[model samples]
Target: MDFEELYQDIVLDHSRRPRNFGELAEAQFHAHGDNPNCGDEVTVHLKLGANDAIDALTFTGNGCSICMASASLMTLKMKHKSRAESGELIHAFHDMLTAEQESEPDKRLGDLRVFQSVRRFPQRVKCATLPWHALEEALGKPAGGEVSFSEDTAG
Candidate 1:
């Protein structure tokens, strides 16, 4: 199959049967993010291991295919990553989606690169990024986790 077909299949598969789609009872960090424009909502749960490595992560939410797929792929990519590494990935992802000049997907993004095309659709960019913003919020603070994004605020 062609690359476009493969990418679509991967996205569809993840959206239909998202990985790590649940809650964590003993999570050290958790945060919720919502997009007011499209009504996408997601909560990210994270458990850190030795030296702030990501021990486990999951997400719970309802959104469009792009959002669900992104959450799924992000959970898979973040397994066992350090907090610093995850932060880098978050920045790379944001840059990939918002860059004024399109470029090849960053190698660091792994399977999450499937969403590269999302940048072309400005509206869908928010859908794909809602879960990521939630993840970022969970990592940014120690308590009282919540984040909200609108078309005006989200890049």
Candidate 2:
């Protein structure tokens, strides 16, 4: 199969059998993000090690396929990474999701390229970005004072 086929399969598989799909009963950091336009909401929970590495990451919420799958993938990728590394990955992924053709893509996103096509759909951008933004907040970034976005509003 080609890249598109593989990407579709991954997206569908994650959507149907999402990894990290539940809550963390004892999370050190908790952050929630919402896409009001599509009604996608997710709460990410993380536990950091003494060195600020990600000891654990989990999420619980309701959202579109893209939002949930992205969260699943994000947690999967975050395991064992230092907080700083996780922040870098978050930045790279954000650039990938928000970039226009003129912007350079981050190769580290790998299979996440599936969402690149999503950029074309302005309405879905929030769906694709919700997880990354939530992750950023969970990592203790300023995140510009709690992110709330709607297709109808500035967000």
Which one wins on TM-score? 1
Residue ranges of candidate 1 with Cα displaced over 4 Å: 1-7, 143-155
What lDDT score is found at residue 55 in candidate 2?
87
The TM-score that candidate 2 achieves is: 0.83
Q: Look at candidate 1 and tell me the lDDT of residue 129.
A: 80
Per-residue lDDT tens digits of candidate 2, residues 1-155? Answer: 34353358688778788898787766777788877666788888877777878888888888877777788888888888997788788888877767665365677777776777666666677887787787777787433223333333464
Per-residue lDDT tens digits for candidate 1, residues 1-155, read: 34363359889999999999999887878888877777788989988887888999999989998899999999999999998899999989988888888898789998888788886677678888888888888888765344443444544
- Cα-lDDT of candidate 1: 0.83
Using lDDT, give the best candidate's number.
1
- Candidate 1, residue 28: Cα displacement in angstroms equals 1.5
C-alpha RMSD of each candidate structure in angstroms:
2.8, 3.8
